[model samples]
Target: MVRKKLYRSKKKLGQAPGSVVYTGERPKEKLFLEAFDFTKDTYTEKQLTNIEDCFEYKHTETVTWINLNGLNHVNAIETLGKHFDIHHLALEDIVNISHRPKLDDHDSYLFLVLKMLYYNNSHNLVSEQVSFILGKNYVFSFQEAEGDVFNPIRDRIKNAKGRIRSMASDYLLYTLIDAIVDHYFNVIEVLGDKIEDLETDVFTNKSSDNLSIRIQDLKREILRVRRAVFPLREVISKIVKNETNLIQNQTSTYFKDIYDHLTQITENIELHREIIGGLMSMYLTSISNKMNEVMKVLTIMASIFIPLTFIAGVYGMNFKYMPELEFKYGYFAIWGLMVIVFLVLLFYFKRKKWL
Candidate 1:
């Protein structure tokens, strides 16, 4: 009986009011808030529960970063939108999980979308959409969940070790984007390791169900990485060119750094694709070689049996040979002659290296 094949779909459900929309099944509601207020010499971080509390420090001339872990709270989003004068479409795109990685510039703010990746416990790659709205003084980030890969950047900002916290919102946006792009490198590293393991298996072992599944999985991951990373280069390119004053000249340099990173990532993806193609070829060649070996063995067995079958048929003829019937040891002589013929053929085949 043929078995039904199962596949995972990439489609996601439509966004609903006060819902956490993702590119997969419905996710649970999880909202976390982390606020960072920093200047040249002092910094403060606080985990906030109410969005109104964030307004207290909004106009303090400090670069305030408000990170919202989930976008399911429509009221909070609306409140922030009214407070910061965010464009309606930018707010809508924040709740819409299906938005591609892009940059949309409004007169007062810049809307940036990106995909964040992490290796899950099952060693499979997972992704989430993160959207950024850069205003005059505050930078708001909306993500699918808390505890993103931005912890390192947060640490750096907290320690006052970098020029990031002292810079404008554009630089902060660059740091956030740079962190996300760097995580792509991490994801690619995992994929690279998987490709290496697949290469080893393809060369040393016959193609099995598991091996084929692995190759396909790796291909899917590479495609996913491509989708997440390829457009980011354009995003950075636009930023570096200073298409919008949202990114200042000094901040454009940081965007250039991100552009270089994206270039390296794109190159890595292409190289991994070549590696996957090579593994596929190796798999096909292995199968072909095995089939050829089987055909050779079958051909040799048929060749050896053909002559024996003919000799037996001749000896079993209904009309016996008169001279052979008169001899008492005729049967023994026939068997010995057949043995000699078989030995000769075996020797020939061995000499020709066809056995």
Candidate 2:
């Protein structure tokens, strides 16, 4: 069983606040930066390996989205941090991917840290830390790795399929968060299917030796997901409640929609956890019942054989002057008597429902 681990904050224990440190995973993939600039009537996209390419849109009123795929490159993060004038603490949080789901509100922008969930090819649940800085006319999205669960939002921007192109930076932020939250549904669906298989294995006559391990793994994953999603409600409500001016009134409703989805995800996770717990209890109970049935059968056989064993012992005794042993019909008589005794005991036991 995998237990939930406490985020060890020891790395920053003696360090000063705003000190930048990479706290979570260390990836080997090279960093890739993608910039999307769009408006109600215009759209532009670029893929640049250099951070300097994004500097031109730093002060522009045209909504620009900068997505950096890897966080292992600390120098690259510092360059963008300098350009945007992002606070040292925000930069620190960006690099320290272990930071939980939280929102840090500043006057010019809102900094948010989120957990992006995805499933690998093996259907194992994977979590990546994604941080966002929502500025007046620009937003910076920092991710821990190259591939992401944001293809829907990318497709939307590429195809002009939705109102996202016409929306402001805050709406774009909400839309992107919604995209990440929507990925949870796929994880849940895949896990739900696995749970169905586990249910059969658990309830079937043939027990799987690996059932316990799979249950523990699933439970641990569910708990991890719940931990990531529960705090997201507060993160979105901070926006909906307008704690930061970066989120406009019109865009607040969209955040509320995201909050609703987070709520549904949380409820589903909790329900699954309950079912898994019930399955555990049922497994134990089923084993107990099986043992009891076996014991009852053994006990019944012993009861039926006790008197017969006594009669056999009485006749098998070594004695030379026993009167019954000398009689010619003694063997037949004893056999008839033993048969009568067995039938009478059988009848009594059957009547008492113990047969």
Best by TM-score: 2
Summarize candidate 2's per-residue lDDT along 1-355 as a digit string, tens digits: 1122233366667889988776655657688999999987888999986988989997887899999987888788988889888999899999886778999888988899999998988777888889999999998999877788778888888888889988899988988898899998888887788788888878884566777788888998898788789998999988889888888898998888898998898889988999899888887788788899899879877877788888888888998888999999999988887788788888887898975
TM of each candidate vs. truth: 0.87, 0.88
Alpha-carbon lDDT, every model: 0.81, 0.85
**Model 1 poorest 10 in a row by lDDT:** 1-10
- Per-residue alpha-carbon lDDT of candidate 1 for residues 37-145, written as tens digits (9 for 90 to 100): 8887888999998888777766778788889976777678878887877776677778766667999889788889989988877887887889998877778999866
| Residue pairs in collision within model 1 | none
lDDT of 1 at 307: 90
* lDDT at position 255, candidate 2: 87
Worst 10 residues of 2 by lDDT: 1-10
**Model 2 compared with the native: what TM-score?**
0.88
